[model samples]
Target: MSRPQGVGDGGQGHKAKHTVLALAVAALNFGIAQGFFAPLENHPSLLQARLGLEAAQAQLRATQSPVSLQAQGGVSFFEVTPPPGPPTCPNPLNPQCITLPSDGRQITLGLTFTPFPFGDVSDAVNQAAIGVEQAALGLRQARTQLEAQAVEAFLRVRLAERGLEVARLGVRLAQASLEAAKLRESRGAASPSEVRQAEASLRQAALQQADAERNLTLAKQGLADLVGPSSDPPPRLIVPSEGTPPQVRQAELQLANAQVAYDRAVRGVLPVVQGSYTRNTSDNDSLTLSLNSRTLQPSLSYTNQSQGRSAPQDRIVGTLQIGLSANIAFGVLDALEAAQKQVEAARQAVEAARRSSKQQEDLLRSALQTAEQGLANAQQARSDAERSLAEARERERLGLASPLATLQAELALAQAQLNLEQAELGRTQRILDLYRFYALPLSEVNR
Candidate 1:
């Protein structure tokens, strides 16, 4: 009785599964385009560099307005004090000058100077930092999701590959049984019905074999698509060397790191408030030189002009002045509020993402548990089949079993062996799953 080879060194299966899983993991890693790639791991401050650079350059390029001395052309006005003119004196020609009393007895002219306020270069820096952080955060979220997908794919390939070996063995054993029946029938010992039964069995085995083959083929194709450079499927069951889960802790670790990175990036979304105050003063040379607090008793201005065509007694006078000024604009508060709202929204998104990830972690843990149980059950079934085949062989040797009985025993044995193979396959698959759950690639686990 030729029984299919059921046991393996668990080496080849491990290697194959690990390789495929690794390829899948890498594919996901690259696809994310965010997580590992998006965050400025080495330089969180790099985001602020642009603002810093521009500010430095602007500062260097900044030109200060010279205290310009030029021919002033704008309307200039000022108050002057004249000598106490007799308010009650009604001199015929002086009536218009100072008929009634006035606070200031004279008039004077002065020029006002103002400077335009400019925007800070630092704001541009902050904006760029904000954008970089947002982009980095988005990419990170996508990357983490991809990592999970990769792990799942890797585990799937390993799972399918485990079932392939036994299924093929079943086909080989059935063929052997069918050949034996044909030989016995040709010698007129086996019944036609028996031969036909064997043939049918063989056909069923073949179908199952074909199915396994298809699954493996499809799995290979999937792996190839994920990894740019790949290898053809290796022959035989590939098993991990140590039979241990590889990189099983990586998943949680990666998620943790991602959380921290996202947190830092989020800070950029906060509203930045900026303000400054300045005091300045400038005036015409005459106004500056003549302005004084000295109280003119007469509260008036008088100018005596004895030059050019003016008569020697001709006089013109002006008064002194003092004052305060101010200006204000609205709407800065509204802009600040909008910026704060945007920050709040970004923070909320981060929280939502974290909660979702936690749930995914829980689901993965459940999948791992199921896979472990499946592997154990398959192993137990294989052991039972082996014992049944041994008993059948012994019964046949004693002539207590008919050819049909022996055939049944043989069939049982093949099925048992197939089950064993499946078990071994299942075991390896479970390990792969564990690796994936941890967010580690098959290569690390298999190795």
Candidate 2:
């Protein structure tokens, strides 16, 4: 629903109202938006797709070398004539040898696109999903906190409003007392000392009224910050439903998400499947096939090399090769080790995050309990004050109590009523907190 036009700068004056519905809606919207943006930022497959072009810059160098094929045949029995090693032909697709095209040697095929493992991509997407989910939860929690704050602010404004009224009433009562004293003094029934006392009380009451007005002003401003300036009418504290709050059940979700992330990171050690084909001109042509099924690769290549660039005397040759290229030109072991360490570190971070979430739950629970107890105590005090006020009014009506006495009793009663109202508000806020921490439905609590 659209809100009424508010006061102040339309953009900068944005303020969320202190209402259960508003709070809940804000939280849900924030959560949904956060989740939607996850893939664009942190998802692995998404990131890989974005980074593909950058990696191409380096992969382009792969074409510079000619594909070489080496064939080794193991005979069950020693042969008088052993087949020569696979002729270094242009078989770039072959993982067995480094093809150097600049040496006017065999042309090797370009590196074939080996689709990244689904397992790893799935893990990344899952991790990102979890993070976005958690962020949304956090935003909801923040909204809840804001809701609680708005409720409290409203209560404060009410207290200040009532306080100001009481102060004004005190001033009036004091003036009445002074007038009575003056009348009695004129008839010689009241002494000068009594008149002085009445005058002092009036002055004191005026000061108190001023103080109360200032307090009220501050309270109104505080509420204004939350719900925007609703000069439409003063806001009131809503009686929130008596029940648990809505929260992200972070303690459990954290542990669950972390375990999943850790599992995914560990699973990344598996080699990705790879295959490629290449044909070159230095020799007639060559085709190499490679599959990354394990740490080591098992591959094959078929090549037909002419004596020169011509296809004349081009003999067909095929070689079966098993190549383990863990380390060759550059120290790729360091890179592999770094990747493994990165995965391991992520696993550790997940565990840490889970622990932190657990601690937060415990702390929030403690706060909720304490606030609830305080509210109960405040309510009891209010009931007693109300009874006292009733008795004082009855006595004043009967002329058994002085106006001063009755005025004091009324003042106390007003303060107590304000306190009770505040307590009720506080309890409602604490309940909202619980809902935020548990990720429970706001509807469940608000209803």
- Local distance difference test, per candidate? 0.47, 0.58
Worst 10 residues of 2 by lDDT: 233-242
RMSD of each: 18.3, 15.5
Positional deviation of residue 438's Cα in model 1 after best superposition, in angstroms:
7.5
Compared to the true structure, candidate 1 yields what TM-score? 0.40
- Clashes (backbone N, CA, C under 3 Å), per candidate, total 35, 24
Residue range 320-435, candidate 1, lDDT tens digits:
34443322236544545555565565566556655665565556556656756876776677777677777777888898775555556655655655555555555555544434
TM for candidate 2 is 0.52
Q: Highest lDDT: give the candidate number.
A: 2
Candidate 2 regions exceeding 4 Å error are: 1-119, 187-194, 229-273, 278-324, 327-406, 432-444
Q: Which ten residues in a row have the lowest lDDT in candidate 1?
A: 292-301
